[model samples]
Target: MPGLGEIIRESQIWKSIFRHPMPLDRRNRIVVMLTNFFLHLHPVSIKKQGIALSYTWCMGGVTFFLFLVETVTGVLLMFYYRPTVEWAYTDIQMLRDVHSLGILREIHRWGAHAMVITVWLHMYRVFLTGSYKPPREFNWVIGVFLLLLTLLLSFTGYLLPWDQLAVWAITVGSNMARATPILGHEGPGQQLLTLGGVDMITNASDARFALLGAREVGEETLNRFYILHCIAIPLAVALLLAIHFWRVRKDGGISGPL
Candidate 1:
């Protein structure tokens, strides 16, 4: 009689799901790698040095892990927090005091900070390892974009608290957009671009207005940042991350040596 393992492998349910037997042989291994969705994200084989903890530092993995943590905790926080001026600050307080869910906010906050640090370190390690050369150049560009998205995610989330620090910080930060060349009212090229001899860029219509959805940071800014932090930026980051990982696999797995 066949063994228990063999019996399970031959079952219809197993065959339907896995579509392959145990990867005991090279052909089976190849088939398994290609057929599995998660496995396909990685190479069939990676160099020993590429996976070494000392060399890789596992920063990429840590960063991705923290992103997952943030996603989970952020969703939990959203159930309690409101995006309006009246309830936003009170909701945060409720999470901390009333519901005792303060740990979730703390975890999400620290995870965001950790993710930023890990992404920078990951890029630094890639540069030091010469991983951005030749075939990996395009992926490096993707990484740079991902880094920007990470920062944007953090910035947008900063205003959700609806506190003095959050409001003023966003005010100072958004003011910088007013200095954006050509697009900003106070920017260098604003005077040159005129519609019927009238300056097009103004305080009412400039990059700052576009960012805040108003002349200043208030209700509109709070709602806009809430949507961006919880929806827009995260979706964009997810898309870029998918491309980044695919490129890593296409560029011959993790970079190892020269």
Candidate 2:
């Protein structure tokens, strides 16, 4: 039998995984990188002095990691939750009372809230460092979209609890949607929805009806929101997130000292 070293060296699968066809110079750069975990974060090494060790509040990557954690925990929480008015609030209590971890939902809930704050802070940090310049501009735009998706995910989630807070907040929010330019009363966008003869500005046909599942916020609204919260929003966030991460790699990573 071949020695252990020979077996690993000759394994076609291992070779494929580790193979790189770069020029010698390019290959050496990659080798030096794969040899260290922390240095792998950069596209190229720089003088340690070049890093603004004191000024860089670089936590955007950390925020993204935390967002992933919240997404995973949120899905797990949904498995044990019901969004119907009758049981929705009770389910939250039950998840806490009877969930396998005893506090799984609590952790997920707070983690979600924390993610919102951290993402905002991450954006603020980038703005402070002037990282929004040049080639990084497009990445910033993508980051903004991810930020909005995070907020949407949070808003959809707030309704799943089906408590007084959830209902009233969604009611206020849907009204704000109705007030939007194309869709709201204030904009030219409302004209198309009037059905030529019938009026849409009226509550009967306005955007609020579909969103609230009735003329006013109630049970069915909560149910529809539950599906959106657990499935639709999560999927959108995932796709945008993949783009967000890919942009980081394409943009040459966090802006470093000149």
How do the residues 123-213 of candidate 2 rate in per-residue lDDT, one tens digit apiece? Answer: 9888987888977998888888888878888888888877778888988888875666655554456776656587667565566766777
Total clashes in model 2, counting residue pairs 3 or more apart in sequence or in different chains = 0
In candidate 2, which residue pairs get closer than 3 Å at backbone N, Cα or C atoms, i.e. clash? Answer: none
lDDT of 1 by residue, 29-74 (tens): 9998889997888777778888898898899989988988999999
All candidates: CA RMSD (Å): 2.7, 5.0
- Residue 29 in candidate 1, Cα distance off native in Å: 6.8
Candidate lDDT scores, in order, read 0.91, 0.74
Q: What is the lDDT of residue 26 in candidate 2?
A: 70
Model 2 ranges off by over 4 Å:
1-54, 185-196
